[model samples]
Target: MAIHASPRVTEILAQKYVEPLRESGEFAHEIVESLRAYVDNQMNIPAAARSIPVHVNTLRYRLRRFEELTGCYLEDTSTVIEVSWVLEVFGRDL
Candidate 1:
């Protein structure tokens, strides 16, 4: 919170991740929500899907598309941490 609120870091992080997701247009919210759910569920696809009440395949597709758009692989620990941090920074903004 300090880092995000103290400077332009919030904007920077948002530009790096959120903006690209937003480019997905109508699907932006869906993808972001899916990502939040996935991360919150500890990357457990089934759990994430159940939380979202979406099909497993649908969550999988959103995650895949998230990777494609952000060029960030969810399989990487650092990537997940970084993405999670970015998500935290934006929160409702996303």
Candidate 2:
């Protein structure tokens, strides 16, 4: 709970992590699921797409959309760490 004491004054880290995402009208539960699948598959598009039961292109689109929404490129190590942390922390809630 101490993590909530950030200067940002957000709520739980997981909730805070997703705040901007939820504020984006384009955000969807599917995006979260896709993220989970994608990360779990080690960012492998083919495996993630198959796991999500979506086309690979669809998965790529979602990834691009996620980047657009968060301004965090999946190819970036820092962003990957941040997003993977978000997913690891809040994936169950999603």
Candidate 3:
């Protein structure tokens, strides 16, 4: 059976797991902005890079660095989903 999650539950999970990534000082504001945009766009890294006016490789490198700093892999489906939800719920606060 497929499991479905409520929006509130998703949001809560996001708050618990994702929001701290943005507040961390390990990445620059530009990198955080790029990551937020990418998560919002559903992991469209190339499009996010274009929006940020950075090279795709540069974006990838930044993302990798973020993962190293946070011990969270942005490319993982679960991590991406949580990060996306967090950005949607609290990105403006950051």
Candidate 4:
């Protein structure tokens, strides 16, 4: 699980996916945090929700909202990969 570690790549990915979430305001952090948990939990809704200490329904809503806002499907490999990298690189700052 090696990141490209390219600053430019991170910047671009952040701009495309992560930035929008940030621009979305305070709730955006919760969304990104939920997404990170979702990915960390291997996309298992229950597991992710538990990890976040949130209700499954809440997590589901956040995920759905994320997809709706970003137009990036979690079920897509490319989206997941790019997002995973962005999370690894810029997640803390976001």
Best by TM-score: 4
lDDT of 1: 0.85
* Candidate 3: segments with Cα more than 4 A from true spot: 1-27
Clashing pairs in model 1, backbone N/Cα/C closer than 3 A: none
Candidate 3 vs candidate 4: which has greater TM-score?
4
At residue 5, candidate 3 shows an lDDT of 47
Prediction 1 TM-score vs. true: 0.86
Model 1: worst 10 consecutive residues (lDDT sum): 3-12
Off by over 4 Å in 2: 1-17, 24-27, 92-94
TM-scores for every predicted model: 0.86, 0.74, 0.63, 0.88
Worst 10 residues of 4 by lDDT: 1-10
Ranking of predictions according to lDDT:
4, 1, 2, 3
lDDT values, one for every candidate: 0.85, 0.72, 0.68, 0.86
Q: Whole-model lDDT for model 2 versus the true structure?
A: 0.72
- Across residues 16-70, which tens digit of lDDT does each residue of candidate 3 receive? 5555555765555656687786876668988888887889999888788667756
- Across 57-91, the per-residue lDDT of candidate 1 in tens digits comes to 99999999999998889999977887787778777
Ranking by TM-score: 4, 1, 2, 3
Model 4 has a clash total of 0
- For each candidate, C-alpha RMSD in Å? 1.8, 3.9, 4.7, 1.7
Question: Which of candidates 3 and 4 is the stronger one according to lDDT?
Answer: 4
